[model samples]
Target: MSNKTFFSLHGGVNVIGGTKLHLTSGTDELIFDFGATYEPGKGRFDQVLTVRPGRETEDSRAAGVIPNLSYLYSPTPSKHVAVFVSHFHLDHVGMLSYLDPSVPVYLSQPSFNLLRQLEVVGEGIGTHRDLRVFPYGEWIDFGRLKVLPLPVEHDIPGATGFYVKTPEGTLAYTGDFRGHGLHPEVTTAFFARLGELGTNILVSEGTRACEAPRPDAYSESEIGTVIESAVRPGKSAFFMIYNRNIDRIATFARAARSLGRELVLTPATHHLFRTLSPEEYRLARPAVFVTQEFRVKGLPPWIAGLDVPRLTVPDIAREPARFLTELPYANLNELVDLRPDGGSCFIHSDGPPLGEFDPAFRNLKQWLRDFDLALVFARSSGHASPEYLKECVNLANPDILYPVHTANMAAMPTPAHGILAVSQLYQKYYIPGRRG
Candidate 1:
């Protein structure tokens, strides 16, 4: 029971999505982030096409998209593995739907609420019912290990990092964080607590820790300024952004309001906004254009109660400059009705294309060209830069460092700490020491 072992089930090297890490303290096995990968062509799964039915897990297992953790799928009860999720991102929890029903899945209260709402609205991707709301700042104890979920700032709400008091030593895992997000204090507090706890091994995400520098980057507050400066009063503005990014939406709403323009949102986007931030929703209500399509029969009570203005595509075409609307790539057909003039600006606040391999990006570029709208991009990455990562490593000062969630390990910046271990998938790293 004294020998502690660690290995990654996925996301070991040159992998982006499917991030699953396994740590064992003499049969007290714990699995963190049993998520799915986003390599569409290789894994043969994407936003449009899904795995073969009735064999989701089996086919994924065969394709190496998900690990064949036999213990999880055993028909008879053998060993119970505790599964913990850090956030609500699909890439981080996409595979949860296919997991064994017997295994317990833990998630933050906010994440649970968001998922529940999505499930109710029919946008949920088969959420597991065996979910427990994982509380922050409190440690949940197993026989030999204790896990503490700590809140961290990211693009989405309920993003968390885990602090595991293992048999070997304290291990800190930063589950996708950024200092430049809406709440810098959240990240600062996390590091402060990590410094106090004294982590021996630190597992961090290097999503943006690439050799190439992020262009036109701005802090959360500065994003509003950049957007405001980019557009004029007589021009229409359309933003292509993730609806889950509540902070970015709020910034856009505030900036649009300052410019005396209506911040028009698709019904789905408006639902997410009203559900996540009621106060911001109320504030942005006056300047928001709720689409006619949003006036459905089964409108949620909260959404129905809000006195939001319902606007049609023709309404926007009449006075395009009076609105800054949301138009995701999937809904590019709406642009035909809006008929935006050459003065319209398309602000691409989303991160760089998931690599040039993504076809959706090419389609989006073609659409923009066809519409003849000028393009502008202003965004802050959700992950810390390599230079800032070095600063975080210095601040935490862990004994061992393992960087995950990056494409190229060679281009990633190293931690200031002397010990850097490049661990392989399923290759056990023996950790020495035992928790009291």
Candidate 2:
């Protein structure tokens, strides 16, 4: 009972997204990042072949998606169990709604706030009523153990890593993070803290851990410059990007302001901006609102009620250079309305599709071709490359490293520490120097 143990419920040897891990000290337990994995194309279930709401637990078990954790969701959990969400990425927090309200789920303050905003914008899947705020950079006592939440930088806000101090030793869990986003120092500071704590076991994301080290990865600042360079004097600039990426939005806003153009946003995106950083909304050039006629169907009263000035397709078509608007893959139909000038530019800020075989990319390409809009890739990956991953492993200098969040662990370059441990699902591994 004195020993500290870890169980890799998911994301141990596989690249699947539902990263569920259980840590235990005596009778107390904590589940980290209970989310769903990504299924390429359509596997057991998809948007069309949906899981019934009332039977998600049974259906998920049958489909081999989430593991059986009925104990955590029981009317009274036998152990003091709490679930912590790392971030708001769909692959990371998609399954949260299925968790029973009896089990307390925790997330960063900003993430909780953003989740509320997303709910208002109709992006949330189900109700998460038992959710609690997990404060960052502070240690919270859980029985005999103490867990410290450390803020980390990612494409999305409220990303975090955790350090759990048990009687045996400390376990460092690096939630999805990258050093090239808006603030690289956050990661740098996290590495320094890990070194000081002498983290015994490190669970790190190896998203790009298989790729070769290259200097071509652009920092967030570099992305802004690339966007600025592509905006010709009289050509409209429309960017297709991940709407949740706040740093990218800032980059686009900065570039558009420099060009003396106002940034245009869809209702959903504007809601997200206002919820996350109202100050940025004020500092940035006043944005022009546009209704999403097709994607969101109709503009809800919440959107129509806003006092911001509205811009119609006719206004944008008349002076294409006066605005920079976002166009996602789902909303490509807007191209028909804007009828951009021949020289107008379309920046594909979102990287290539998950695989070349994806049909969505093909559709996007055909649309761009038909519209005569040149596609320019002005984007950087949100994950660190393999070489930098090795550097991070060495910097932490943990006693053992378990790499997750990668498709090809076999192709991963070995870290300098030479302590990569191949963890398996459901196997309890006790850290070295266990307490008697």
Candidate 3:
């Protein structure tokens, strides 16, 4: 048997999200980030037409929703195989349920907490018995291959990058990150550590590479400022944000406080906040939005036991100006009861129905029109800007570059003194040993 290490791209390539990278050294194999893609309305399955029960893995594979690697999804256990998850984003951890539970799946502590919280809300990726938590900067060894989970700053908490040490050389994988988030120092330190380690190969995410400039790309602080400015006195303001973006949630909380309006969150968002950041939850003291559905079906034990104030549709409709609430697109029907005032507005803060491409975006627009709510955007991307990406590449100073999680591979920055090699899906590229 040869001692050469090999690498292959099984999922995220020429696309944004659904990153799966396979690395092998002899009999030991490592799979990083088993996730699904973010292309809405392009695939065979949709909201109405769902995957067949008991055949999810098979159906998804046949429809090209997931990689066609049977070994990873095999029912039988393989001791030599181990999986590493970078964060809890659905695009990065969506397919873990299909993976064999016997395989040891490793993640950060915050990622684990968030995943369990999501499970409580019926949005989890199924259960796995062998979930393990990896501490930041600690090395986990598997034969000749060792991986170090380095914390990074992304929109979601517990986002991480991996530094893999193979017999051949060292490779750095940036799962997903940004410099304009709440913590830029974390991102800076990550690249600084990569440089100190003298990494040989860089596998980076290029979500914004070659994409046209977004006018709404504000920094986290800037987003808060925009939110504050958008919410006028004597008018209700609804913010639609991704539940996992705790930083944005804090921003909304602060903005509401500054505007002297009560902050109201959906039950799911409230649960996530209390579970993930208890200290912040206590400080914010936000109210929970109690929908008619929750009243009819009875609140979950978590919501029922909460001591925080609750806001009903009638409560908000009576005094719209006193509250700044979360309005998820799924709960758009609640607008019929709330009957927002004349000057009220809806603030889209990096939530679902994200863009014109998604089918639900049309529905969101229709709802806003029907409710006569002014739509405004106050959002920031979770990924780094193109310039920041180039800066990251320069800082890492890798000998070779492999760009993933992007639609345009050609747009990725090449190392000043190294090779820019794009790995084809399922095609293995051997990593030469140091002595070879």
Candidate 4:
């Protein structure tokens, strides 16, 4: 009888029979991702609507981030359990600001650091949420709730899937993940371990399930060959990509070296490199530091003494005349587009554009055309690809598959079996309390 699985508060799950479990037991209730929904019909991030009283409710109605509660309107402390943040993306962590401060929230360390940086860039305010930042192997105890962070790769840093050990059983919540080869093999190895972890009720992210298979991603070396073959000495390659993907940076740097150009690191990009490990920061050694130092809170963490090539923004040229003459030897393309000037080439390291619609193609072409530059896109995504996404579902073999964080939110269909589509309205769900 204790093995019964009921459909309680199933925001994004499928339940057999009609068993509804209230979201509370003892002093804990497991609140999964409370994502923030942006206002509908708006182009980009217009502004953040505060989650107060009538204003937030009104804003949610107007913006279309429906199913949002007024606040932590729960009447009792023992009724609500701790919140588990799947990943660091704003949508997944959106409602972080509005939750009851007494409720414990958990996130990865890197994600927490990135969140802090983002929050500083955002509303310019600190938080009062009782967040406990844990590493991949550590666990947190919230009375009866036992939680652990399992590492995963995404476009964001410190991305993780969670495993919760409750009195009822062990449930794993995959905030967001992909089975793509884009991530190192270690990523898959981690998931394989999760499979052995005996995930009882799996809640996975099926965001790309319905999307068609993307092209085979190129390795950093193969991409370097493309860059070397494409660019001539007189071209500068410019890149645009997500800041969280540190792997792409290493790829570009190594590729630049193979092409005979000293790896050029932008100031903003340099800080990220400096913060990573030596191997992780392996950017074409005999490597050149285009920027001197990365500053955080007015102090650099630690400056490496490794001898590498380097240049500053002001030193792109000598007397503003022979910018080409000072350009590093080898990989420097004599002819190409995306220039700091006539003899410069660029690589748009920044990743693809996100949100409702991507402007990457349009904006990229426009930027190149605006300066009469030529370019090629060498970018890859952090999400899992189709085949891998399929594999994760197959490996986990859950009863239902749910997807989020994309325009085709509901498009990610379940491969396991039948589907019970949660209505787009009210979206109420119930789950039984875990027997202690």
Could you estimate the TM-score for every candidate?
0.90, 0.90, 0.95, 0.68
Determine which window of 10 residues in candidate 1 has minimal summed lDDT.
Answer: 427-436
Maximum-lDDT candidate: 3
Q: Better model by TM-score, 2 or 4?
A: 2
lDDT of 1 at 76: 55
Better of 1 and 2 by TM-score: 2
Which candidate tops TM-score?
Answer: 3
List, residue by residue over 210-267, the lDDT tens digit for candidate 4: 5675463544335556555656664555444554566666666666556565555543
Segments in model 3 whose C-alpha atoms lie over 4 Å from true places: 432-436
Candidate 1 C-alpha lDDT tens digits along 240-343: 77767877888888988898888887666787887788899789883334444443454555456667776767788899888888777766777877788885
Give the CA lDDT, 0 to 100, for residue 436 in model 2: 25
**Candidate 2 steric clashes:** 0
Residues 16-67, candidate 2, lDDT per residue (tens digit)?
A: 4667777887778888887777655746897788789778788886676765
Which ranges in model 1 have alpha carbons more than 4 Å from their true place? Answer: 1-4, 45-50, 74-77, 125-127, 286-307, 351-355, 432-436
- lDDT of each prediction vs. the true structure? 0.74, 0.74, 0.86, 0.50
- Residue-pair clashes per candidate, as listed? 0, 0, 0, 47
